[model samples]
Target: MAPAPSADTLGTSAARARSAVLEEQIREDPGRFRMLTGDRPTGRLHLGHYFGTLHNRVRLQDLGVETYVIIADYQVLTDRDVADTLTEHVEELVLDYLAIGVDPERSTIFTHSAIPALNQLMLPFLSLVSVAELSRNPTVKDEIAHSRQSAVSGLMFTYPVHQAADILFCKGNLVPVGQDQLPHLEITRTIARRFNDRYGNGGTVFPEPDALLSRAPLLLGTDGTKMSKSRRNAVALAADADETARLLKAAKTDSERHITYDPAGRPEVSSLLLLAALCQNRTPEEVADDIGSAGAAALKKTVTEAVNEYLAPLRARRAEYAQDRAYLHRTLREGNERARAVAETTLAQVRTAMKNHY
Candidate 1:
């Protein structure tokens, strides 16, 4: 497999895109606010979700931004060998989100399959987007190649367009994303620009959303690969203490018998240190320094203890919420309603501008 691109390259591209967005934002509105970010409901969110994306969303909610948590249920089929099990996966994801302090009242949590207006926006946006541009999107290409599917469905092919609908529906001006997802956000911005230029009643109908840069941690699995449910390399957020402990105990560490923070040569040790720091909001250097004179065994033990302790409260909250099916459904029901209210409004204006006249 080809090596992943270095952060230096990704950083340069991100800076350029962010500068362009910021220039437009200042000219548009100084205090403009609205955020859109979503997760693919392909499986239950793991520690990667918490350390990577969820925590940022929680912070955005606290900052008084209108946060929309979209479970891209429709995106699941884009790369599934068996798509029938998604219902349970989506439920577990919702429960996990709630357990992590994603308040539905402040954050609109809705599934992609339930939002009709957003899907409708996909139709016209699709018309405006070209096959070449979609094919050029790094994420769609990477996903298609990764899925190894013999024949990709049209829905899978146009997942980015659907994402544009997610942002445009809410007129979302900010998108919280990591480096890997910048390409997808770029596609969304391009679509927004194309639509506005073509049919944006006089002034641009859609404000191009900028990537809300997140200081996301690089999460790894037990095998030192990227954390993924399919690889069984992930520790689920809803996992009990015993489960988390077992996963951590089995986490891939080196035979050096000593811990070090050198990721260049000691990836496994670095991974464990990264995980511990993420769990406790400390720097890996800080954690390593605090583990002075404590060898590898002691370092791993301390990290494991810290992670398990941190997640204990989250697990309790998850258990309580998971038991109430009615509450889950009701929360989602209301969330979908709120999401649709905003989505339908933008979609209606889009229709009028495009002469769809629905």
Candidate 2:
């Protein structure tokens, strides 16, 4: 007989089952769901962001899910200082979203700073969770280690709670996240449940959001590490064909002459293969098979061509959007107003539930 599954395995299986159910429900009645997902205006979005989350966002939007994208500008202060370039990064992110088919008309896109009521939820949310729970959060620990700061900020410590506010503010029921992000979403679920239990008085306030696990695999950097703009190993979606080629040229690959996709034994080669496969809508193994015996040079060339070709239309659209700064700002303004209105309504409900609306 097979051995019993471990707790971790059971948890993963449960998440998968829940994700499948959510997907089916989304297909049947997308209007019944509200999705909240976004990025920090830290830097220009790269291929990782494009293939990982942006594509999925567009898919959900097209499926008619009411989407709320928060720019999380405040979150950036948790790790690094990007005050000087914050506005620039925000505008560029807007361009990427538009180019990638996230229609402002269909999906609301707003920044954290613009929604006061959203941030106000943080106070009550902070009271629900203990310091020990916050300290035990794996995501926060991982981020702190990655940031390598000598001293962590209070904001950074309570980052998960801030994320909770982001979700519950607009009553987001479906959050698109990768496996690694489950812990953060778990905290959000906990807060929602605790809030309702403590103050609901037979009325539930925030929906206990379920994770919509991302299907995309983690895309590594050209240097065979995590893809990040700070590392100078990422290929931004706004990069031109020449820039894309230049970046791909420096991608790490083994000395193996023959091309193959082996993520464990040959991560670098397989990463490039995966990049090309994602762009071409094919499997990495199929791509490696096509390039067998062609060598690393051939692999790099294929990846460069595939990435450039795939991003060509998006880059073109981004270029056009960048030309009209006024329109871009206007889009943000409208989204902020919409998000603020939603947040205000949710805040009112919270206050009434807690008898603090006096």
lDDT: which candidate is best? 2
Residue-by-residue lDDT tens digits, candidate 2, 1-358: 9999976678777888999999999999999999999999988999888888889999999999999999999999998744789988999899999999999999999999999999999999999999999999888989898884678889999999999999999999999998778889999999999999999886789899999986777789989998998788899998899988998999899988988888999988998999999989999999999999989999999999999999888888889988998899999999999999999999998888889433
lDDT of candidate 1 vs native?
A: 0.82
Global lDDT scores for all candidate models = 0.82, 0.92
What residue pairs clash in candidate 2, if any at all? none
TM-score (all chains, Cα) for each model = 0.90, 0.97
Model 1 agreement with the true structure over 1-358: per-residue lDDT tens digits: 9999887587657666775675466446534678888788777788888888888778767767778888888877777767788889878888988998899888899988788888888888888878999988888887787775788878778988888888889999888777777878878889899888888756888999888666677878989898987788998887777787788888887777656688889887888898888778888878878776676777768778888888999889999998999999888999999998988888888878888423
Candidate 2, TM-score vs. the true structure? 0.97
Per-model C-alpha RMSD = 4.0, 1.6
* Candidate that would win on TM-score: 2
Q: What is the total number of backbone clashes in candidate 1?
A: 0
